[model samples]
Target: MNKLKLSGILAVIALFAMASCTQKKESNSPKNLQIDNKILAQNLAQKFIITDGHIDLPYHLKSMGFLDLKNTPTLVDGIKGDFDFPRAKKGGLDAPFMSIFIPPALQKTGGSKELADSLINMVEHITTSFPNHFGLASSPNDVIKNFKSGKISLPMGMENGSPIEGDINNVKYFFDRGIRYITLTHGKVNEICDSSYDPVRTWNGLSPFGKEVVLEMNKQGIMVDVSHISDSTFYQVMELTDVPCIASHSSVRKFTPGFERNMSDDMIKLLAKKNGVIQINFGSSFLTYKYEKRLKERDSLKRIFMKENNLTGKDSLAKAFNTKWLEENKLYADVEIVADHIDHVVKLTGIDHVGLGSDYDGVGNSLPTGLKDVSGYPNLLEELLNRGYSEEDIEKICYKNVFRVWNAVLDHAGKNN
Candidate 1:
């Protein structure tokens, strides 16, 4: 063969060899797992102990105006709400903190304690009504034990501190009642701390009584949740808390600029420094700035529509109008956006400080597209897999990080008490 012809033949052989190697590598990648993403996601979900930092099941049930725990649609099918037994099982969610949410109005009406107690009763009623399916998890050990027995763990976290009724001893009272975490305030300023949503700046950080509450909480082993409090309150709590803290159902503020409801990059870094965790909120508003604006506009329009039509919220006409408006201006985000928030946390801190806290049922109908309910967790796992996260890292994101914080709180309590 001529020299030029021989060189061309050699290059063709090399190209063929390279293509074969590339094909082999592709087949062996994590993307080539058996079956579809749904199955792979299911497998991962089952393989790990998935713990969500917050869920508003108690409030959701209360909003329905009644409770028949065993016979309720929530324990059965739960097509309306974001969480239920069937969906939780399918998603492999082992532990979800049942939010004992106290509305801010209750503070003025003087029933915050009573309302909080009722919700706590409702949570206990679930395990009493269906012993085999669900059980109460008061600690990290309890969660693991429940997971082993193939049952979902219902841990409780109070959404607002108003239930404490300004008494520091109520912190221990709640801790004894299976309340594992407490969001200092809700959407309004309170005695403990100011809320991110409230204009009043209240105590600036923590009130003298709020400082006592923080110490009592830490000594009692309750996780100080910085989800709904103002930025100043978060820093103050971090300063006061001896044990690791958690932003139970919050997303990074980087995505939604000026949204104090979400944690800023500085706060995230500081949280990680305290060995704390920021469980990413899956709500559309928490994930993107653009969607937040759209949600506001939609709400404003809905208000106008209600007034123009003389439709009270109780009227069917108002419900229909609100439904139609949501359908017309759907600003749903993709599940991948949630993964992006996780990525942001992981990049700023590490895999050890990020976890899932979907804010399910609490965000109402504002859930993201692919992650509309409890069953959509696998979609999130599939996204993480696509992003090249290893099984160990995924496990850390699933539960280990939060478990560490939970255990740390317990340990701190042991010493402090």
Candidate 2:
């Protein structure tokens, strides 16, 4: 009995000593850069896996022929983009859903299956080609397996419903190919639904085809994503989807109404009741109300400029604008702003429905300042911790609630998702 008591006492002492040491390390670091913040932030994410539900890796890689993810360019080096395997590990990022973003081809020549194939090829190329760094995650078990194997999760998700091209079988085909969720639309209307960001309201709400698509996704056990969807389409999905859904990356409409990229308080409330989570999008336009107006105005002017220059609908124009602005101005959203987005969702919908989806790679150079890379996640946590968020709540925002929803959807899906 004495020996057991001694062992227990020693264990308690060791734990205290370790915690005390950790606190000391955190307090002693004058700068937030590379000062053991990883360990501190990870401790906060332990209640659930530290996860960012959406990451546009394939799109970014396809768009920008950038260097390998294993070797990323840091913010200090003035290289803007910085999400890599090492950084994700440092951030305790467990399950990062890699979005297979299908770019809009006006003609719709290749068809959804071919596009799905391209997306799958990109995912497979990343996961199979580099086994040491990443793994294919199809289910919650896959997440655990990859985590245990010291590998980053490369979950496949579809950003635009067009990949299904009005066909229900494609939804199941996507699931079989390891797609877990499907965003209803993106920037424009498709056969499935209308987009909130579209200048012309294509369907006002979900079309009959859209309703069928939602039903098929639910039957297939896939979580329906409502992020780039029109308000009516959102409501339709809301009423129709039995499984919990999510806004993979969206902001609060109250903060920036006309942007139409963020969800309203009423929508947020409904999402909460429906057991859905909205992973806060970290784009500057999404965060501040002013930026939305600014972005639209600037984008409009740039479009006129491109048109005058005979460059109609050139996608590369946006990239050029981003590069120009980043080089010319010091204006960038801070890590606090990201925390503010998280706080907004927490304030409007409570802590349960909020999650982080940094929208890394997709936004290119527009990432939140201190959070320049996956490694910079700790800075956001420190800001959150400073704001009086409990370790438990942070866990839910970081990953627990997301996982809970994922698991709940899994239960609903029964066989897949």
Best by TM-score: 1
Task: Evaluate residue 62 in candidate 2 and report its C-alpha lDDT on the 0 to 100 scale.
Answer: 54
RMSD of each: 3.8, 9.4
Cα shift from native, residue 127, model 1 (Å): 0.5
> What TM-score do all the candidates reach, one by one?
0.88, 0.78
| Per-residue lDDT of model 2, residues 1-417, tens digit only | 699999999999999999999988877665643344445665654325667767887666655653234433232223335567766777777788888787666316656557557657777766766678788988878888888888778887888888786667988888899888888888787888888878777678898898998988887877888899988888888899887888998877776766777898888889998989998887776777766455676677777877777675646765687568657655567888888777877877678998887788787666667877777777888788767787788877877787777778778777644
Which pairs of residues collide in candidate 1?
Answer: none
lDDT over C-alpha atoms for residue 358 of model 2: 78
lDDT of candidate 2 vs native? 0.76
Residue range 1-417, candidate 1, lDDT tens digits: 999999999999999999999998888766565345557678999888899988888888877765445444448545468888899888888999999999999888899988888888888988887788899999989989999998899999999999999878889999999999999999999888899999899799788998999889899999999999999998988888888999999999999989999999999999999999999998888999989787788788878988898888899988887678778876877898999999999999888999999989888777888888888888899888777798899999999999999999988899978
lDDT at position 285, candidate 2: 68
**Reference-based lDDT, residue 135, model 2:** 87
Residue 94 lDDT in candidate 2: 75
